[model samples]
Target: MADIKAVLPGDVMDTGAAARDGAVLRLGPGLVQADERTSAAAAGVLHSDGDLWWVAGNRRRYVAAEGEPVVGVVVARHGEGYRVDIGSAHDALLPLLAFEGATKRNKPSLAIGTVVYGRVVVANSFMDPEIECYNSHTGKSEGYGELAGGFMFKCTLGLARRLIGSTAPVLAALGSELPFEIAIGVNGRVWVHAEGPEKTVLAANAIRNSEYLDAKQCRQMVKELLAR
Candidate 1:
């Protein structure tokens, strides 16, 4: 039986058979089939919802998935799009026309090494993933596009998720000490901007260090960092 716990690769979540209770099980990300076993493909905490099972890992790498938002860096310009490194197995495409209100004659210009936040439009194992900077339905930017000045850095996907959580205690604690703006990507990138560079660096370091900390530990960490 699969119980709530931290799991590693090759740790079996279940067998490829129906549960004894007659409930069907579904596999989510970070899980793969091996023979008749469903095992973890990454290291992290295991989570389940109803019959669904998935793993959340904290390695500094990105896994591309459709509809997921990610932070990307422009690597090169292709014919009609830009090649973006989203810390994935494959580089993603951010087309020149993928922005809000973009047109042939009104394309946005981005230099190499530009940081961007976008949603994955296409992510298939057979091809490179594609990203878009606009909401297709509303045709608005909606906070997706070339990210402005900030101290951008990378962290583990698990840490990124924790930082992005609405009630993350680390963020709350840091907010008490510094005024900052942050953007978190599920793909393991973070951008932080504060009134001063020192505060931004402090906030970033605090977040990265708080990955393994509990709520109380996180508050203590913030206090220690601010005192330095």
Candidate 2:
């Protein structure tokens, strides 16, 4: 089982898991390194995944972090890039050449309010963040690009994280019932597409309601939804 404990601001964290020789520790949101020690920067539950540690709090506003996949809406076309609203304090810049194989002569023309899935390439507190529609290492699209013809909705950041996990019972339950395509962004946005609008709405609502449900409860909820 994973170690999960509630913590308050300024609480020192046990660094044993991150203290393995030659292992580098990665700190996530609400955690900070002060005086060469790790401590909580916000009141939340402490969670550790391998050498990465973070504090999960009830925060609706997003703080951009590099390499996190996000779903954003194009709000305006700026010079050489588009300003995207990624549920952050500031809009992120998506350069025209950020897409796979894009160049000066050939680039995507995105309209305002268009939805896109991209990864954070640069996130600095001093400047606005930047995003890209392709994998920098592999130079592949990797399913990062415009998200077209889907129903988008917002949920809590915690719920978004849960839906993105590999073992999300709600997703598993929904998958067993019908075919659907989903795009989840850590920024608390979810896009769902199914064979029909009704099915899409059903799947999205199931996901929203399953945030606090157990595995068995998820399955039962899906069954009840299908019966109605």
Candidate 3:
């Protein structure tokens, strides 16, 4: 793992390690290549995963990428697919045959406003994005499907990623005091549920307010929420 640091636009990233390994580097958002050099295109933290680099910041809207899991809401059914709103500029397509056990004779019937957790299968600038609720190779739902009976809300993409990542302190802090089920999508959608509606509301509010808090601060915030 490389040490990440804050970067500003036009700042060149040190890719000496990747160059030494003769690896082709993949640049993620907020970076661009010019004059045979890669430089930051936006102000944010720079991160590297071996030969890949990306920047993380507080992004509210989503730009679909292949294989990234996202939560979507069904808006319309057209032919063999459903149009879903994933907080992206274009509506994503959720195909009927893309589910784990779906068939032409038995397609998944999703009504308008139904919430779902799925993965982006195809995304392009000129075409509509496509999402699926099942793993193509394993042919299993694998936690990707319709979400029922929960409150769904949107957050910054940076916060959503943190909630889904391993070092999510806000979730851990709240989990210690209450039991809840949460589904986080990288596209900024979050669905939360608990044993009761009041607990669920509390949990959701705690998460909603934890965007800028550190681990210790998040714990204190959760404690205060519990007290209330």
Q: Identify the leading candidate in terms of lDDT.
A: 2
Better of 2 and 3 by TM-score: 2
Error of 1 at 158 (Å): 1.4
Residue 97 shift from truth in candidate 3, angstroms: 1.1
Over all chains combined, what TM-score does candidate 1 have?
Answer: 0.79
Kindly give the stretch of ten consecutive residues in candidate 2 with the minimal lDDT sum: 16-25
Cα lDDT of model 3 by residue, 86-140, tens digit: 9999999999999999988988899999999999888766899999998997999
lDDT, candidates in the order shown: 0.82, 0.89, 0.86
| Per-prediction backbone clash count | 0, 0, 0
- Once fitted onto the true fold, the runs of candidate 3 whose alpha carbons sit more than 4 angstroms away are 6-28, 31-43, 49-52
**Model 3: how far residue 98 lies from native, Å:** 1.3
The collision pairs in model 1 are none
lDDT of 3: 0.86
| lDDT for predicted candidate 2 compared with the true structure | 0.89
| Candidate 3 clashing pairs, residues 3+ apart or interchain | none
Positional deviation of residue 92's Cα in model 3 after best superposition, in angstroms? 0.5
